[model samples]
Target chain A: MGVIFLHTLNRMRGTMLGWGLSLAGVAILFMTFFEDIATQADTLKRLMQSYPPEVLALFGAIQDLSTPQGFLGMYFFSSMPLILGIFAVLAGSGLLLQDEEEGVLDLLLAHPIDRAQLFLGRLLGMMVVTAGILAIAFAGIALSTQWAGIDTAIVELAKSFITLYVQLFFLSAFSLMLSLLMPGRSTAAMTSGLLLFVAYFINSLSSEVESLRQAARFTPMHYYQGAQAIGEPLDWGSLLGLLGLGLVFLAVAWWRWRARDIRITGEGAWSWRGLLVRSRGSSA
Target chain B: MRSIEGNAKTLDDPMQIPAIEIKGLTKSYGRVQALRGVDLEVRQVEIFGFLGPNGAGKTTAIRCMLDLIRPDGGELRVLGMDPRRQSVEVRERTGYLPGELSLYPNLTARGMLRLLNSLRRHRADPATIESLAERLALDLDTPIKNLSKGNKQKAGLLQALMHRPELLILDEPTLGLDPLMQKEVLQILREARAAGTTVFFSSHNISEVEEVADRVGIIRKGRVVEVLEPESLWDRSLRRVRVRFRKAVDPQRVAEAPGVTLLDGSDGTSVVLQVTGEMGGLIRVLAQLPVRDLETERPTLEEIFLALYRNDEED
Candidate 1:
C-alpha cells in the first residue's frame, strides 16, 4: 500500500505543483486589488443595489466590501470552489480510469498488491495532493494579507480554506464514484463537471428563486461554506456531512473496482443498452 | 480430449504439484465467449506454449489464471493454490508479461522497474535487473515513451524475469522483436526453465513455440483443440509432394496410394500429392512410375495449426 501510495504521489507531483502555483498566483493577484476595491466599496455597494438582487446573489452579495472579510468573500472565496472543483473532478476521474484505459493497470494489478490496496493508495495520494495545493494557495493569500493591509485574522482565512478543501474532497469522491459507474473517463468527467456547475448555479439561484430552494438542499454546493466561513464559526455539521458522504462514495468506488473486470483499451464503450443490461460483475 | 494425464501428479506425490491447473474454464465478454471449457495442466519446470490466433481466449485464460478476470465457470489453481481465493499469494510468486504491454511512459526504464520491484514482497535484486537489461540490450535510462517498440518489449521481458519467479506467464513473449532478439528471448526462457521456473507463454507464432516449448496447446474459437508434444506436431502434419513424370502418367495409380491424396494435376506429366502421416507408401508407389523427378515440401507450423483447427471443426 505504501509503495503504491508513494508512486501515485510521485506521478502527480507535477500536476500538484502546476495547480498549486496557478491558484496561488491567482490568490496573490486578487489580493493586490484589495486596497483599490476597498476604497470604492461605497460606490460599488450602491451600484450593486441598482442591479437585480438575483444578479447580486449569483456572485455572493457583498453586503459590506469595506471590511476585509466581505472583500475577500466577494472577490476570492466565492469562486474558489468552482475553480478548484474542476481540478478535483479531473484528478479523481482520471486517477485510476486513465491507467486502466491506457492499459497500465493490468500490469500494476499483476503485482502483489490487491485491488483494495491500490484503490486506497491512489485515493490517499490524491487527497494529500489536494490538501497540499490548498495549503500553497492559502500561503499566498496569507502573505498578501500583510502586503494589502487587510485586517482579517489568519485563522479566519485558514477556516475558509478548510471549507474549500472539504468541498473539493466531496467533488473528487463523487467524480471517482462516477468514473467507476460510467463507461469511460470522459463520460465520468463530463457528468461530474456538469453536475458541479449545475449544483453551483442551483444553489446560487435558490437564494432569490423560491422554486429552486428545496432543490438546493440536495446539491453539495448548499453545504459548502464558501465565503461565509470567513467571519463565522466553522459549520461542523456541513463539514462532517460532506466528509461522510465522500467516504461513502469512496467505498462504493472501491467495491465496484474490486468486483468488475479491468477492461483492455478500446474493448468497451458507452451504450444505453449496455448500461441497462450490464451485469454487476462485468466490465463496462 | 487430450488432457495432461501422462504428467498428472497424484495425492501420493504431493510434492510434485502441477504449476498451473485449469478445468472447464469459461469466460465471456458480452455475448462474445472468450474461453469455452479450457482444461489444461502445465507440469512444473516445463515451458508450455499456448498457441492461438487473435481473440482465441489465450489472453483470457492467462488473465483468469492470474485472477485478473474472474472466470464465468471454472476451476483455476496456480502452484497448487486456488487463484481466486489466494490471488495475492499466487501473484507474489508469479510474474506476468501482458500481451499488450503498457508502461509508465514518463518514467525511465530503471525507474519503472524500481517501482514495480518495490511492490513485490521479495524484491528483485538490482544486480539481476542490471544483468537482464544488459543481456536484452536495453538502456536503463531511456524513458519508456522514448523507447522503440522492440525496446519496450525488452523492458517488459526484463521486469518479468527480474524477480526470477517460480512461474512466468507471458503473453506474446516475443512480439515485436527482431529475429535475433527473438532467439535471445527464447534462450532466456530456456534459462528460466533450467532454473526450475515453470514458464507458460502464449503466442500466435508457431515456429517460436516449436523451437522452445516442450508441449504445445493449440486453441481456436475459445476451445483447446489439441495438446501434444512438439515432436508429434511434425508427425501429424501433412507434407506436399510434387512428382514430375518423364511422360504422361496414370493419376489413378498415385491417387490409390495409402495416406496420399492427389491435390492438383493441371498438366499431364506432373501431380501434387498431399501426404499425411507416412510418405513411404507413396514413395514406393511412385517408384513404379516412369522415371521422374520429385520434390517434397514440408508443411509450415501454420499449415499444421490450420489443419488442427479444421480437424476440430470437423469433430
Candidate 2:
C-alpha cells in the first residue's frame, strides 16, 4: 500500500508548481468575492442588471456572488470542480499506466499484493492528494474570508469543500480505470476529459432538460450540483451516489486490470497516444 | 490427472525440495501459444537458468509462477504451494527482476527502495540497502529520472536483493549493465546462492548463464525442450570434425563411414565432410580421403538452442 501511495505521490510531484499557481488563483478569487461583499456588491449588482437571465442560468443563477455561500459556489464549485476535475484526471492518468510503460508493472505485481490491494492503495494515495488540495483550498478560502472581514460559517464552507473533494474520489477512480484499461496516457487523459466534460454537462443539463434530470443520475458529478448546494443546505443522496459510482469504478478497474496484459516497453519510439491508436487498430 | 507418483525423484532430502516446480504449464494468447506444457524445476539453493529467444515462454512462465497471469492448464508450485491459490505466500519468499527494468522515475533511488521496503512486512535493513547502493555505485540521492539506464538497473537490483529472500527470480538481469557491473551482479548472485538462495533466472545471454547457472532449461515456442546440467549439456556434443579434401569424395563411401557426413562432394577437386560422435572413426574416414585443409568449431548455445527449436517446430 505504501509502495502504491509513494508511486502515485511521486507522479504528482512534478505538477506541484502548477497546483500552487492554480490554488493562488482560487485564493485571489476568494479574496475578491469577500471584498466585493463589503464594498463592491452594490455597484456589481447595478452592472449585472445589464446581463440577461439566461446568462445567469448558464453560470448557475448566481443572484449574489458577494455572499460567502454564493462566493464559495462561484469560486469553488462552479469553475473549481472542472479545474480540479482536470487535476484529478491529469494527476491520476498515469497511476497504473506509467508502471506499465516503465515495465515495472510486472515487478510490482510480482509482490505479494493482489490487484485489489494495488488499485485500492493507489486510489487511497490519490484520495490523500485530493484531500490535501482541498484542505489547502479550505485554508486559503478561510484565511481570505477572515482577512476581508467577511465572517460566514467557515466550518460550513469547509464541509462543502470536503464534499467536493470526496466527489473527486469518484473522478479519480474513473480516471484510474481509464488509465488501466486504455493503453496510453493520452488515451486515458482524453477519455477522462471527455467523461468529466460530459458529467459536468449532464449535471448542468439536468436542470434545463426535463428528461435529463433523472437521466443525469447515471453520471458521477450529477450528485455534486454546487449551485443547488449553495442555495440549499446539503444533498446526501448525490454524495452517496458519487460514492457508489467510485466503488463501481474501482471494481471495474480491478477486473479490467486482472484481464489485461500490460506490454512492457522501455523508452520506445512510440508515444502513449501512438500505442493507444496502434492497439485500437490491431484489436479492430 | 493424478500426480505422477514415481516421477517424484527427490534429488535430496525433503528439506532440499525445489523452491519452484512447474509441470505441463500451458498459456496461449489467442492464436499464439506463449507457453505449451512447459515443465521446469528450480532446486532450493542453485542458480537455475531458463534460456530462450524473445518470443519464447520464459517471461510467460515467470508471470504464471508469480500469478500475474493464470495458466490455461498444468501444475505449478512455488515453495510447495500452488501459485494460483497461494500467490501472496509465494511472493513473500520470491524476489523478481522483470526482464524489462522499470522503476518510478519521480522518486529518488533511496525513496523508491524505502517505499518498497515499507510494503513488505519484514522490512529490509537500511544498512544492507546503503551497502548495496555503495557496492553497485548507485547514487541514493539521484531521482530515477535523472539516472542513466544502468543506474536504474542497479537500483532495481539493490531493491530486489536488499531483503535477501530465499529465491531470486531475475529475468535478463544483465541487460543494461556494463561488463564490470554484469560481473558484479553475477558475483552477487553467486554469493546469494552460497547463502542458500535459489536463483531462478531467465536469459538468452549465453555467457551470463554459463557463468552462473548450475542447470539450464531451454525453452522454444512455449515448450521446455531440455533441462540439463550445464556441464553435461556442454560435454554431450563436444566432439565434431569438419574436413575439406583435395579430391572429390565418393558420397556412398562417406555415408557408409562410421560417423562422417559427406556434406558436399559435388566440387570434384575439393570434398567437404562433416563428422560427429566418434573422433577416432572420423579420423580414420578422413585418412581415406585426400584431405587438403581441416577446420573444427565447437557448437555454440545458439546452434544447439536453434536446432532444438527447429526440431520442436518440425515435430
In the range A1-284, model 2's lDDT, one tens digit per residue, is 66677766666654654574568567757676576463676777677667774454445545566676766675567766677889888767777776676677877787777777787777777777777777666677777777777776776776677568767787778888777666577788899999888777766666666777786787666667554454366777777777888888878888887766656642222456666887898999
Worst 10 residues of 1 chain B by lDDT: B1-10
lDDT tens per residue, model 2, B203-288: 88766787889998888888888888776555444433455666676655655667566666675555455554456766666678
lDDT of 1 at A207: 90
DockQ of each: 0.70, 0.46
Scored by DockQ, the top model is 1
Error of 2 at B52 (Å): 1.3
lDDT of each: 0.86, 0.73
Q: Candidate 1, residues B66-85: lDDT per residue as tens digits? A: 88888899888999999888
Looking at candidate 2 chain B, the ten consecutive residues that score lowest on lDDT are B1-10
